[model samples]
Target: MPPHSLLELHDITREYSLGKSRVNALRGVDLSVSAGEFTVVTGPSGSGKTTLLNIIGCLDRATSGSYRLDGEEIGDRDFDALAEVRNRKVGFIFQSFNLIPVLDVAENIELPCRLREEGGRNQRALRARVEALADAVGLRPYLHHKPDELSGGQRQRVAIARALITEPRLVLADEPTANLDSATSQHILDLMLRLNREQGVTFLFSTHDPRVVAHAWRVLHIQDGKLLSGEYPGVSRRASGAS
Candidate 1:
């Protein structure tokens, strides 16, 4: 593990057992992500990109090797224990946006905090924070509007706000802009980059989108369940005029 790495995976590997077969999703992959760094993991479909991310985010346990998140070794924890750890330590943004259809924008952003300990008891404070986040995401006008009332870009903004509701140390995104059009995707990417730079929030996302990779300060490539060096580096706003 590198010094000051908020997330570290050492020789991590995962295997899924079919009834009569075994599938190796990750093969001895080691990675270290420091705090406040915007990193992207890139790979083709079924190349273990999501699998590696799942392991780091504590959504999936590694079959072999050591994994440390926020300085604690977590590879050996059971499912329930891992869930608790993940909820407290990491925030996730998915490809689908995953907003509640019935809940308004503010309510959706505050959902994670509402699931936390004493969240209900601190309702007023949570509401205030949610409103602030809504404003920050430029969704203040739609706070009372349900998911059906918003466009794709607005919905993704809501997702980003919701992911940061808890003020977690790390945020993991799985192709968060995959469902949006190029223009909307660029808008969403700009929002994430602004948040990362302004708030110093660490972001690690997996994507096949070169546009997303173009903004990443560090890029890690995976192929055939193994980490491989690629020509994805030297990419940034300064390098490619991508924001």
Candidate 2:
């Protein structure tokens, strides 16, 4: 692995048992992501985008390969160990905006911190950070509103804040803008781009949205369980204010 690499995967492959046949999700995929990269993986449905993200996010293990996160070998870790690494090192945003229906915006954003079992968190500091993140994401006014009371975009904003509140080393988002309108999708993308530029947040997304792909610093294209030869730095780096 390179000195600055935050994620490295070598000849990774994933297989699933479906009914009576084995399904290949990934075929000898190799990838490397350094800290602070704004990258996207784009592919058609069933082309392994979600599977790849799951492996990288520690939600699922590859069938065979070596994966290292921040220089630590974790491909073989057990479920409990993977859960620990995931909680401490990764944040996630899903297409469904998985917020609790009963929790208000502020409560949803602060949930990750509270889930930690250590229990030494400074309550005042946590609240401050939560509010600051809510403000940043344009959810300050809706801080007291529950998910059912907000628009789809607003709920997604809350999800974004929740993901960032943990301050994880990497954030994995899968079709984050799928449920929003075009305008709302653009707004969400802009917010994420600003965060990536200003805070150096490393983001890895699996998206079908071309607009999202257009803003990426790097793009990886996969197909039929194999990576095509389209991995390259996107031309939007300077135009999008990426450092």
Candidate 3:
């Protein structure tokens, strides 16, 4: 593992049993995502994008090989241990903007802080965090609104705020802009980029959008459970082009 790598997967393999047969989701895949890097993973459907994200987010375990997060080996941890790691170290932004319909923006944003038992984040501190994130994402005016009352873009911003509430080391965004329009997608992408740069928070996203690919500092192309190429900015235009 590289010294600066916050996440590392070494010859990782994950297989799912289907009756007497097995399906490989990831096969001997070696990947490393360094701290403060905005890395994007792109591939066609069934290309192991979500599977890889889940493994890195500690939401799932690989069937074989080694995995590490922040230099700690995680392949041997149980499900509960994985959950704990995810809660403490990883933040997630989903395509669907999984906000509770009944909760207001402030409540939703502060949810993660409350979950970790990180006391002393009183109502005032929580409000401060929510307001800062809302302002960052251009959702400050909607702080009192419910999820159903906001537009798709606004709700997604709320989700982004919630994801950052914990100040996690890594943010795992799985198709975060998939549901938004082109203009809205650009806005959301810009917000994520700003957060990654300003906060020095590492971001890893799984996306198929060429726009998303264009914004990434590094791109990983995966196909059929294999890593085909790793493209860094200005290195390989052909490889960077989305397939």
lDDT of 2: 0.90
TM-score of each: 0.93, 0.94, 0.92
**Residue 9 Cα positional deviation in candidate 3, in Å, after optimal superposition:** 0.7
| Model 3 deviation from native, Cα RMSD in Å | 3.8
Clash-forming residue pairs, model 3: none
TM-score, candidate 2, is: 0.94
lDDT of 2 by residue, 158-212 (tens): 9999999989999999999999999999999999998988998899999989998
Could you say which candidate leads in TM-score?
Answer: 2
Write down the TM-score for model 3.
Answer: 0.92
Better of 1 and 2 by lDDT: 2
Candidate 2 stretches greater than 4 Å from native: 1-3, 118-120, 233-243
Q: Rank the candidates by TM-score, best first.
A: 2, 1, 3
